[model samples]
Every structure is written in C-alpha cells, then in structure tokens.
Target chain A: MTSSSLIKSFERVKEDNRAALLTYTVGGDPDKKTSLNIFKSIAESGADIIECGLGHGANIGDGGAIQDSTYRALSGGIKTDDIFEIIEDFKKDYETDVIIMTYQNKIMAYGEEDFIKKCISSKVSGIICVDWPWPLNLDFAKKCKENSIVFIQLLCPTTNEDRLKNILNDAHEVVYYISMLSTTGQKLKVSSDEIKKRFNLIKKISPDKKCIIGFGITADTINDFKDTDACVVGSALCREITRSINEELNPATNVGNMVSDLKQKLSS
Target chain B: MKLEKGIPLIDQHDENGYWGGKFGGNQIAESLNYPIEELTREFEKLRNDETFIAERDYYFKNFVGAPTPFIKLENLTKHLGGAQIYCKLVSKATGGAHKAYNAVVHSLICKRLGKTYIGGDTGAGYAGKMLSMAAAKFNLKCKIFMGTKDVERQSINVFSMRSYGAEVVPVNSGSQTLVDAVSECMRWWTSENEEAHMCVGSTVGPTIFVKICAWSTAQISREMRKQVMDEFGEVPKDMKLINCVGGGSSAAGFWNEWIDYDNIELIGVEAGGPEGSSKHAAPLTNESPIGVLHGATQYVIQDDQGEIEETESISAGLDYPGVSPLHCFLKETGRARYTSASDEEALEAFQLVSKNEGFVSPSLEPSHAFAEAIKIAPKLSKDTIIVVDSCGDSAKDSKIIAERLGYKI
Candidate 1:
C-alpha cells in the first residue's frame, strides 16, 4: 500500500520534535469564496493539517462555536459537492494534508465507497466522523485504506482497555483522543497533567500509530498536549471566525493570525 | 408479578446491537461506547436478578399502574360497524402516559448504578413529567432537556416537572423539538456521564438505550397478551396492533410480545404534519433513506446533502424526523406495516374518540394511531379486531387541542 499523505505529514512533524498544528475550519463558513480564502490562510499560516469540516445540521459532538459556524455554512448554501470543490481548490494552491471532518450521515448520504473515491480524487488526506466509532466504522475504514485515505479513529478517556485495543487494531494512520468527556469548545475539564497521563497510557498501548488530541485543545491548551503527534484546534478557530464576523473584521486574516500564534505556542 | 422470561423478539439482536442483522447498533461517539457498554452490562445483570425484578415489579404495579386495562371500545366498534375496536388504556398509567413505565425503570437503574443525578429529554413533556416524578420518588436529582418551542407549548408538563423539583433546561437549538432535545441531552450526558444517567424517552437512541426502554415498556404487551387469552380463550385470528411511532417506544412495547405470532399484524402510525404540505414526520412512510441520527442507524427525513429535515406536526410528541432502527428493521423485513395521519385527520379522530368512547381528553400522539385505526376499522369485517395503544392523556396538549378546536383556552 502507498504511504498516506497524512502519515507522511505526521512523520515530517515528528522530525521537527513538535506536534503538528491541525487547524479546523468549516468548509464554507461565512460564505464559499471567503471559506476558500480561509483555508489558504490556514495552510500558509503554518498549519500542518487542515481539518475542513463539512457543514451538518445537527452537530451533537460540537459545542456552540462550531455549531454556529456549521449553521452559517449551511445557510450560506454549502453542500457536499461544494465542499469537495473547496478542497480541490485548496489542494491546487497548497500541499497541506486536508482531512475532512464531519458527522456520519454526510459520508453515508454521499455513499461511503464513492466518498472515499472522491477523497482520493480531491487530494483529501483523511476522514474523521465524530459519530462513527469502532466496529461500526470498521468497514468504512477498510474501504478508505484501499484508496490510501486515512480513516481517523476516535478515542476518549472513558474508552476501556478492551475497546481501545479493538479500535487501534483497526485504526489506520492516525487516532484522535478526545481530551475530556464533553462536546467541542468546552474548556479542558481535566488538568493538562491528567490528560498527559491518559494520553501516555494510549501511547504505551500503541507505540507506532500517530495519535492526536482533540475536542478541548485551544491556543491556551495546545502546547500542553505537545507530546502527542498532533493537536486539533477546532472550536477555538471557529469561535475566532464567529467573533471576527461579529466584530466586522476580516475572518480569514484573523483566523490565519490565530493559527500562526497557536503554532508559535507549540514550538515555544 | 414476576418479570417475563426471555423476550425472544427484543433479544433477537446480536451482541453488537443489530436487530435482524440489519438495523440498530451503538452508532455513537467513541466516548459513549464505554458508558453504553457499562449500561448494557448492568441492565443484563439487573434483568435476571430476582431482587431487582421484584423491586421493578413493585414499582410497575403500585406506582405506574401496570396492567393498564385492555378493554374493547364498544361504542366505537358498534359505530364503525366493522372491526371490533379494542383499546389498551395506557393513558391510565400514573403521570398520565406510558412514559412512566420507562422512567420508573430507568430511575431504579440509576439508583442501582449509584448515580444520584438522572436526566432525560422530553418532547411533548410527558417524558419530563414522568422522569421527574420517578426521580423525586427515588430521591435523586433530575434534569430534563426540552426544546424551547415545546416548553412554550407544553406548559402543564413543564410545571409538573418543576413542581417535582426537577430543573427544566430549555434547549434553543435546531428546530427546538424532540430531535434537538435528544441531541442536547446526549451532549449533556457526554459531559455528565460520570455522575448522571440519561433516561432516553423513546426507543430511538443507541442499541442499549433502545433495548432498555423497549424492555421497560414491553410489559404493556405482556399484560395485553394475557388479557387477550383471558378474554377470547386464544389469540384472535385476525388482530392488528396499532400505535403511534414517535421514536417508537409505546409501539415497541405493545408489539414486541406478538412478534413470534405471525398471524397477528403490527401497524405503526406516523405524524403527517399539516394537510397537503411537503413537510411531515413520517420517515417510515415517506421512504426516507437510511442514515445515522441520535446514535441509531435508521430512516431519517433528510435533504439531498443528508442534513435532517425540519419536521412539523400538530403533536409535539410526534414531531420527529427520524424513526427507530427497530422500526426500520420491521419495515424492511415486512413484518410490520406503517402509515401516517395528517394533523387534520388526527384532530378529527380526537373529536370522534372523545364523543363516542367518552374518553374526553386523549393525547394527540396516540390520536394519530387512532386516526389510522378509524380509517381502516370501518373497512374490515366484524370478525377483525384492532387494538390501539391509548398511550397518553391530553393534559399536556390542552393548548394545542383547544386552539385547533377554535377555542381560546
């Protein structure tokens, strides 16, 4: 099998001795043209991976900030086909590993096998479905593997040893560890030390697979999880976009500056 | 009253939660898997424990008014001039709805799990009232998530929940109905899983929850089966069980006992919203494509892009865009048939049942079922028997019912 760009991106960041800064933004937040510009800004601002979210109506895993952004995207007329176009447009201008993050219904509605094929053609790197986990995702992940697309598996603090083993056994290139048992955009409920202690346990269980911390990692908390292969800063960036739009500022520039600052925090 | 042994239909699912090798599973966030598995284990243990069974039976008999009367609607059957219409009077249950069955069982489970806090989602607010009542009885704190829209419409139930010292959190998210209420409740459960138990109001969530709720409510069918045997000396030759499908708890409860009896027919009624409108909450009848919603893979009313559609219905309890995965399995296998009743038709049924049967205040949720039964009852022969689960009282629907009836109450 060919090496996935997602794995290569992690390897490149591993050599730098710093976790990759994965910036998340909805595919068509605010609007379509500005969404593409935001993606360009995110990539140019030193984000190793761009987790472009597909706009969904009900984002159970997301908190208010991400949910607002998703609603904005949906109201702005963003669709699955439009999201792919945005990714194709971004891949033309940048080599950032672009993983599509969405709920399960989007992929299921788009046809799972055909969705993987679309990812391959759009130069998308991976997929993170917040609602699909473990045995339910087993088949979809297998199909993704055949097309060299990384299917990211999600784990949480509540995940026990048996389930953890089963999930990692089927995991592909990367695994996402939700820092706490909450929706996105919430402040990290557990201390950084506690998160590290749990993350270390996962790392000990799987030494080779790349792991990332998500759900609670913001600029303030991103550096604390630097031991992981990557950190996904999602709701914070979406919040920045929301704030920028509310304050009549340039969202792309503001989001780009936020990502750059987050990257700087990681290296420091 | 001992718990019935091994419900074959409810237990037919695989270990992973699929029913009939097609629908139902824990299609949830990875964080929820461990807790759901933990719940599955505890529920399994409690199901067989004699003491637990006795405790649950005590609550079912004494508190929830279990063995709710299965009586023939004589006036309606004679008026229809066709099928013998029978009604399982579930509205007679305490808290005025069948939700009390699931709520009492879930609250007992919460106490056994050593959790002091219990939460649930409510649509027309029956679940909230039932859970609050049960939680207060068990000396546990209760919180109910309700859509803001429903909060406005279901004031009576809201006040009852509050009177029980339960907090009603108004959810201001998508559509502000039962679907969003469930979404918000699940999100809250994700954060509070350590200290709280989520009592899902219907059989529409992940596999374990669906199983738990179905198990709790299936007692209705068990009692009805015994009643049928006592009344007719055997199962009726041509019988149809009808119940409304809003996440499909009462229907699951009313039909699970009869799944093995192929001669008995199962019919589900869905909310069809306004007359001649494109929007409705009839996923099973609308031929909605299969997708995952609220942790279960089922038929969902969604657009081309897979976003859940905005559903409408006269009954807040039935204003949902998704149906239970078990119902999906039933629909796929052709073991059960589903149809829908529009708001106008249900309203007409509401009036007819009140006038003919003298049940002055029937809840609109089950009125949808009665609407279908009314439509088909007049067509079948007198030998045919149709049983409709009268699942809720109209206490919470006074405003909607009065306004639709041109009254200012």
Candidate 2:
C-alpha cells in the first residue's frame, strides 16, 4: 500500500504512546468563514486528524447536536463544493490529516467517479460514510483505495463475527468501532472496561489494523479509551459550537479551547 | 375458500440487497445490522412455514375479515358511462384500512421472533392504530412514534392507538412528519433492539423491511387473484389496478399478483399538493433522483444540492418525500405506470364518491387514486375495467376535510 498521511499520523501518535485525537466539526457551520477558522484552531489545538462533516438534509446516524450543525450549515447555503473549498483552504496552512464525513447520498448524487476526483483535488485524506456499512461499501472502498484515500469502515457492538471478519478483511487504514448502540451525542452508558474488552477481541482478529472508537466520546470520557489506537470526538464538539453560539462567544475560540481541553484530558 | 401462503413478487436478492439490481438495498448504519439480520432470518423462514401460514390465514378470516368485497360500482360507472369500474373495499378491513394486513402480520412475526416489545412510526396514525390493535391481540408492549404535527392532524388515530394500549410519542424535529418519525423510530430501535422489534409501516426502509411488508400485504393480491378467477372466467385483458403510493404498502399488496400478467396494467397515484403549487409529494411523477432515505435507496424528492425537500399534500399520510423502492423498480422496468392527483382533484373525488356511492369517509390517500380513475374512466372503452383499492377510511381526516371544505364540522 502507498504511504498516506493518515497512516503516517497514526504511526506518529503510536510512537508517542498515546491514542490519536480525531476532532469532528461540520464544514461551513455557523458560516463559511468562521468554520474555516474553527478547523485551523482544532488542528493547532492537537487534533491529530480532522473529520469535516459535509452538510446534508438528513443525518439519521447523528444526534441533535450534529444534526443541528448540518441544518445550520445547509440553511447557510453550504454545498458539497463549498465544503471542498473549506478543506482546500484548511490544507494550505495545516499538516493535520482531514477526512470528510458524509452520508452516502451526498457522494452518490455527485456521481461516484467524479466525487473521488474531487476528493483528490481537494487534498482530502480519507472518508467515512455514516450509512454505508460493510459489503455495500466494498465497491466505493475500492474506488477510494485506487485514489489513495482511506475509506473508513464502521462496526457496531451488534456486528456479528462473520460480518466483522468480512469488514476487517476489506478495511484499509482505519476502522471506526461504534462504542455503543445509540446515535452520536448520547451519554456513554457502557463502561470503559467493556469498551476495552471489545477492542481486545477485535485486536485478536486483526492486530495490525488501526481501530478508533467513536460515538458518545466526550472530554469527560476521553481518558477511558486512552489505551486504544485512537478515539473520535464529534457530537460533544458540535454541542460546544451550539453553546458558543448561544452564549454570544466566538465559536471558533470556544470550540478550539474545548478541543485543547479534550487533548489535555487524554494526555493526562 | 381457505387462505394460503402468498407468493413473493420477485426473487430474493441476497447478494447486493438491491431490488431489481438498482432500487432497494440495506443502506443503513451498522447499529441496525444485527436486528435486521435477526428479523430477516426469522421472517424468511416463517413466511414459508406451513404453521405460520395457517396462523396468519386464521387471523385474516376470523379477526380482520379478509376477502373484503370486490364489487362493481354501478352508479359511478353509469355516471361516467365509459369503462366498467370496480372497487376493492379494503377500507372494510379491521382497523379500517389495508394497513391491517401488514401490521397484524408484523405483530405475529414479532411474537414468532421472541420479541416482547413492538414499535413503529406513523404519519396519519392508521399504521399506529393497526399495529396497536395487533399488538393488543398478541399481548406485546407497543410504542408508536408520531410527529407532533401528525399528532394534531391525526388525533382520532392517536386516540384509537391509546385505546388499544399503545403509547404514542410525539417527535418535534425537522419537518415534523412521516420522514422524521421514521428516523426517530430507527434511532429508538438502535438502543432497544435487543428486546424490541420495529414494525415498519410500509414497503420502505432496508431490504428486509421492504420484503416483509410486501410479502405480508401480498395477501391482498392473493385474494384479488382468486376473486378475479371466480368472478369472471379469467383475468380481463384490459384490466387496470390503481392505488395510492405513500411508501406503497397497499399498492404493493394490490399489485403483487398481477406483476407478471401482461394482460393487466398497474397505475400508482401520488399526492400532487395544491394545483399549480411547487410543493408536492409526487416523487416518482416529479422526477426525483435516486437517494437513500429512511434506510432504503429510492427516488427521493430533493433539492439540487441533494437535501431532502419538504413535501405538501392535502392528506397527512401522503405527505412524504420518498416513494417505495419497489415502486421505483416497477417504474424503471416499465411494468407499472405512475401519475399524480392534486389536492383540488382529490378533494373533489372525496365528495363525489361519498355523495354518489354512499362510501362515506373514504380516505384522502386513496382519493388521489379515485381522482385518476374518475378522470380516465370516461375516456376508456366500455369493455375496459379499472379496480381502485379504496384502502382506508377517512375518519381521521375529518378535521382536514372540514378545514378544506370550509365547514365547522
């Protein structure tokens, strides 16, 4: 496999003996200019990778916070092209690997082959489609691999052994293990030890592939999975953005500080 | 006549999960994989099981009153004076709509799968009422997620569900309607899947859901096929089957048996909103692009940027932006045709049907189909025959009808 920035960043984090911190934020949220600034702050605040959400109409996998972000971004007229532009501008200044998180329709509606071409042009490192699970993602994963982009696979606690093995076999650099059975933003109901147990089982199957736990991961809970390869924090940051907007504060600075605090919590 | 197992309209596509190699697929998040797989395995086995078939047939005959009357509409046919019109009064079924066919079967499957909690999402509440009734029969805990707006519009159904011991939860989210309700129900099922089985109301959602709904309601076509053969010597060569297409459960059932019959032409009618208005729920007729919504890929009404657009219609049940993936497949393969009826036309049809035929409380959803039948009945040859599935009673639509007709009720 060709060396990509996503793998290199994971290796760097692994050498530091700490889990990588991947921050997720919707692109063009609040507004286009403020969102770009927010991305920069997240990267500077020690987020190893940035998962920029592409605004969509319906995000069934997301909770209220991320859904609110998507609605705000969409009502502000943020399109797929606008998100690509945001990523292009963000890449010019930061070395932080960026991945686009979107629903399948956004890619399918844009034409699959043309979407990949745009991803390469926009300097996107990888992609995670919330609704595209397992073998359905096989063909798209192949297209993404041909273009040197990491297509992240999502596995839930309910995934059976056969399906899990199939997914991991086709998985590329990163696989997202949903920490629970709820949507993003729900409180972490499962104990950290249980999460570790699940992670250990996956490791026994594919020790080489890097897996990240997402959904319900917040600053209060970030330290729980410190022993894992990486952890993704999404809805908590989106909630912070909402609170910042409501409090009449600079959202970029507030969200940036929150990410910094999350990094601090993980490291401590 | 003894009720028996109904045939599936198409072969099971286990490879990619897409129906007709294009429309339907299990385009859902991973959190739902286990529950869907469990339901799929059990349902696939039970659908063909002889004991299960007999149990469903027993309920159809003794409980919900299946084999609803298929009668010639003499007055309206004489008034139109062109084609022979027949009405399949599915509205006479228990719970007052064709929704009972799918709902009762789903509840039974829920029992067979060993789940004690049954849940679903409803737009107009017919689905909620039917499921609630079935759940009461099966002695399962039932929860129906309805949009806040739908709760207000479909209060009668809400009352019926509650009377049957089902809790109705109102969701106040984006576009409080059928689409949001389905999303919320899926979210609920994700966390509660271990003990609960979600009963989807229509032939929408993941591949398993589409198959189950279509298979359950295929009983409608089974009865229709027998009635046609027994009534007339054989299937009429110029026969046309018409039904409303909101997620298309009733229409799926009404059209399943005739899919392979070259002699029969199927017509699906969708809500066209107010005349001359841009807002409507006619996704298939309006030329929507293929997009995934509520778990399945189908023709969805979306903006140029691929955002799901709000749909408007006189009837709450028909106010959905997406159509069934099966309907999309049927349309693409040219085995079926689709059209639309405006709010004005549907309202007119409601009045005419109620006044002339004395079929009071014909639902606004099927009124769209009635509008089309009324329109073309005069233009076809006298030998031509059209069967309209009067799928639901409009007791829940009294408020909308009152408001539209400018009456206090």
Candidate 3:
C-alpha cells in the first residue's frame, strides 16, 4: 500500500516536467550476458522505467513481435531463474524502476506468492501479466499490493470509457494505454484525436494515475502520443537488438543507441 | 465428473493453478484482454441453448452421423481371443473420424461468438476438414494453419479443407508440423486480427475452452455409455476404454462421463514412434516432467534445455509435443493409465483392422490406441469387454502410410 518505486521513478522523470521513458527487453534475448549489458546501457541511456519480458517459450499474451522476441530468448536457453541474474546485474548500475511484463505461466510455474517475493527482492517496482484473467485475479492483485509491488493496469482501446473508469480506480503506478487495437509493430491506426481522447479520459478519471501509451509507438510515431505520461518502447528496440544479434554486431551498444537516440527526441 | 483423485478442470492443476494441474497451466481464455466471465458465459449459454442443442442434434444425426454405431469388432475380438473388443465407429462420422464432434461444435461456438473469421491450426488434416466443413455449413469464412510439411504430406487433406471453401495456410516454422502450426495460429490471432476467435481443435487450452470443448464432446461418451449399459447387463466387469491422444480431445470426451464409473477404466495411448528410438510423441509414456507451453500446463516433451522438443510420429495428428493437461493429471494421479504403441505396432493394427473389417482408411492416431487394445485384450478374461475409439478415418493418411510401408495403394 505504500508508494511503489515505479511512482518514484515517474516522479523523478516529472522533475523536468517530462514523461518517463520505459523500455521492454526480454531476458536472454540472443544471450543472457549481452541482454544484461543491453539493460545497463538502456538504463544509462535515459530510460526511467525498464520492463522485462517473461514467458516460457510459448507466448500467448502479447503480439507476435514479442512472441518472436521471446523465441530468441528461449532459443538462447533462457529460463525464468536466469532473469534473476540479469536483473541483479542491471540493478547494480542504476536505480531505474524495473517491471516484469510477463505471461501468467512463468509466475504460475514459479509460484505466484514466490514470484511476488522475487519481484520485491529483485527491486522490481511493478508487475503485469497477460494470463492473470483480470477480475478473476483480483485476489492476487491484493497480494501484490500487500507485498508493496505495483500491479500495473493495461487499458486497451477496445475497452469502453465506463470500463476504463473502473480499471482506473484500481490502477496504480502506471496505466499502460494501448494506443490501438492492433498488436505491437502494426501501423499506427488510431488518430491523435482518439489517442488524446482516451488518454484525456483516463487522466480526467484519475489524474493521480500515471498513463503511458504502448503498442506501435515507434520513434517517429511517439510524437503523436507525447501528451501521455510515457510511451513504452518494446518491439522497436527489441527489433534493433535482434538486428544487432543477427548481424554479429554489439547488440548492447546498438540497442543502447536506439533508446538513447529516441530519448533525446522524447526529451522535448 | 468425479473420480478418485481428479476432476476435469480442478485436478488438472496441482495446487499451482494450472487448470491442467502441475501439467497444464498458462492459458489465455479468448483474446489477450478477454474477460474470463464473458467467455464462460458464452460457453454456458451456447451449451444450454435448447435450439442450439436441437440444431446440434439435427446436424449430428443428419450430416455428421452422430451416435455413430458402437459395434463389436467381431473379427478383431475373435483374433485377440480373451475379450470382446468394440470400436466406437467415430471413423464413420463425417470428416472421417471422431474429429467431427469437436470440429462441428467449435464451428458453432465461433459462429455464436459473432466471429467473422475463424482461424486455427491442425496437424492431422481431419480437424481441418471438419472445421472447414462446419464453417462452410454455417457460412463463416475459415482459415486453417497447418504445418508446411504436414500440408504437403496430407495433400488430400489440404485439398479437402480447401474444397470446403476454406483457405489453407501452411506454416513453415520450426519442425514445420503441428506444434509450429499452433504457434503460427496463435501469432496469427494476436498479430493479424484480434476479432477473429481461435477455433482451437483440442480439449487442452484455457479453462473455458477446455471445459467447453470437453463438454461438447461429452455427447460421445454419453451415447456410448448408454449403448454399453443397454448391450451389456451393466457396465462390464473388466471394462477398459482406450483412445489415441495427440492433444487428447476424444479421450477427454470419452473419459469425462466414465470418470465416475466404478467398473470402467480409461486408458490413453501416446504415439511411441518407431520402436527402439527416442523419437516419439509419448509425453506420458516417458513420464514427462511438468512444463508449460502453447498456453496450457501439461507433460511436455522437452530436452534438458527446456526448449520444446520436436515430436516425430507416423501420424501428423499424433506428432505433437504435448497432450491435454487433463491427461497429464489423469496419468500423474493414476486415475487413468497411459501406454504408447510404436509406429510399427500402429501400422500393423491399421492393416489388421482394414483387412478383416474392410473399414476404409483409418488415421494413425487411433491406430496406436487400437494397437495397445490389441496388446492387452488377449491377456484379460473372456467375459471382459474393452472399447477402442476409431478416432479418425485413414483416408487422409492413406498415401503417407502407404508410402512409408512400401505399399502402392
């Protein structure tokens, strides 16, 4: 029930009156060591919050972009426990708030209570999973709150405003407003007016709740969602890392450049 | 249905909340953000609708031939010696096997859910044929994702699906078979179109889909159980029920009712591939450890690194890395027994039944189960009765099995 680290991270970003920049990196993408290095570089490059991906090879939650991203991580022999080593490594260099956006299977296999304990111990500020079946999982959401870990809510565009109001009431740390109904890497189909309308509604309902737009928020398109509190850069950055790994280049530095370069533009 | 240790949905998850119990967990009910209650409501409403049931009954009786003849395989029973073995002639159903039941039900549910585009993955081509036909019957656009290799091998099956005015998409991913096709189907659902509901052709998925699919197929068990009671005095003393399992949809339906039966026993057969080699789809046969993949927790066939290992079997439908989560629970709790028959044994059973019974082509999936039945039937008492499900027609598998066995059919 106390203030989560994710809130502090957002507060730190707001010190300059700017939205926090969040990046998602699936652990063991390509390899574990390089993934850790990429995390450190992205954290240093100016990400206020970093979201790590978790799934046991089969990703039924996110779009195929993340699915393909997980394929690389899993193909690299990444397991759930390996994520701990990578997180521990990243925590050494930066206080960037860490959140694990994972599939429910990973948490279920690791044991939900045990997973929350690990999240707290790993200094993970927030947790969101696709498999949590929403209201059916509200009890676990309470458990997460008791453990002082923020249970981030995802607001889809397809959801009506009434539902958004209800979801906003329980939301904490951040509201991940998916910009469109499409998956990650799809063309931005929502107009700025609609994005602004939805974001404004979330803000109007709970100005206290931080709202960040995700899904198809690329480097160029990120400008459209500038009015929101933050934009989650996942598939785009992961794609850069994938390109680096595929071409035998330094993935950590290349992805570092991708985020750092985007950071400068978002700094506006 | 109550059993000694397991229920279909509850026991499948072993205190860990995997509806498949330690074996299956990690299921997305419908879409990424779909509320569980809505999906549950749809299933409940559709399953109970009087008109839907009437329509379902009408379709099964007239089109797919439901209540398929539960007949004693007199020739095979006499040859096996000890017990009188019967076959639940599902192979005689439309789409040439037990696949018609689940496929038609899936089609109905998809149409009820107002899904415009119905998409899913299939390995054996039987399901694809059934689903596409259902889609065509219901006037819904259908697209099926099959493994590139399976589509090529089961060319006639692909043709059958397409002939129903459904599009056949070949997935050329890892292994280029069923598992890869499932992955592609999921990707297609999440990435391509969120509105298009996945018509998963298995009894192993999220709680709602698993429960509903099994519930739909339970009609088979209900019909057969009634026939068994009518034909025999009561349930037979040594009644053994055997069915082939890729993802265990038919077995789920078959065992759903018999779970509470006192004298009836359930046996699930896995594809053991060619003998003396580790290349098999036998998750339970090898006592596979608990793992999660493709959205459910089940006994997954995996290597040391935890990556899903490829499954190799004579039947493409049986060529899956995992079985239903319920089967895993049944095996782990000892409520049901699991055994695997090798490709050679299955082929022998296929030829044996085809030659004596003159039942057209039978798919390799049920052939594996019939092989196991053929194995134990002789060891039991003469008064004992055993039932093996002729799960699918072999018409789709004819060319492949013929080519593999060096027969020019």
Off by over 4 Å in 3: A1-4, A109-122, A135-148, A158-172, A245-249, B1-26, B29-37, B191-195, B233-235, B284-287, B302-307, B328-335
Task: Please tell me what DockQ candidate 2 reaches.
Answer: 0.70
RMSD of each: 2.6, 2.9, 3.7
**Per-residue lDDT tens digits of candidate 3, residues B1-409?**
2234345443344433354334554455223444334556787787678999988888878878878778888898888799888888778888787667777777777777777778878898877888899889888889999999999989998999999999999976568898888776766666545467676778666556566667767777878889888898587777889999888888888777788665778899999998887878999889775666676767878764456787788888888988887777677667788889999999999998888677634588899988998899999888888898887888888887889789898
User: Per-residue lDDT tens digits of candidate 2, residues B99-141?
Assistant: 8888889989998888899999899899999999999999999
lDDT scores of the candidates, listed in order: 0.89, 0.88, 0.76
Point out the higher-scoring one by lDDT: 2 or 3: 2
TM-score of only chain B in every candidate structure:
0.97, 0.96, 0.93
Top DockQ prediction, candidate number: 1
Candidate 1 reference-contact recovery = 0.80
Model 3: how far residue B9 lies from native, Å: 8.3
Instruction: Give the per-residue lDDT of model 1 (tens digit) for B1-409.
Output: 1112355656767777877665777778887877787899999999999999999999999999888988889998988889999999999999999899899999999999999999999999999999999999999999999999999999999999999999999998778888899999999998889999999999989888888899999999989989999989999999999999989999999998898788899999999999988888999998898888888888999998889998999999998899887788788878889999999999999989989987645799999999999999999999999999999988778788999899996
In the range A1-268, model 1's lDDT, one tens digit per residue, is: 2236678888899999999899888999988899999999999999999999996777678888888999899988889988999899988889888989999889889998779878888899889999988887888888888888888899999898887888888888688889899988898889989888878888888889888888788778778877678888989899999999999999999999999999999988
Q: Which stretches of candidate 1 lie above 4 Å from their native place?
A: A1-3, B1-7
| Candidate 2: C-alpha RMSD after superposition | 2.9
Candidates by TM-score, descending order:
1, 2, 3
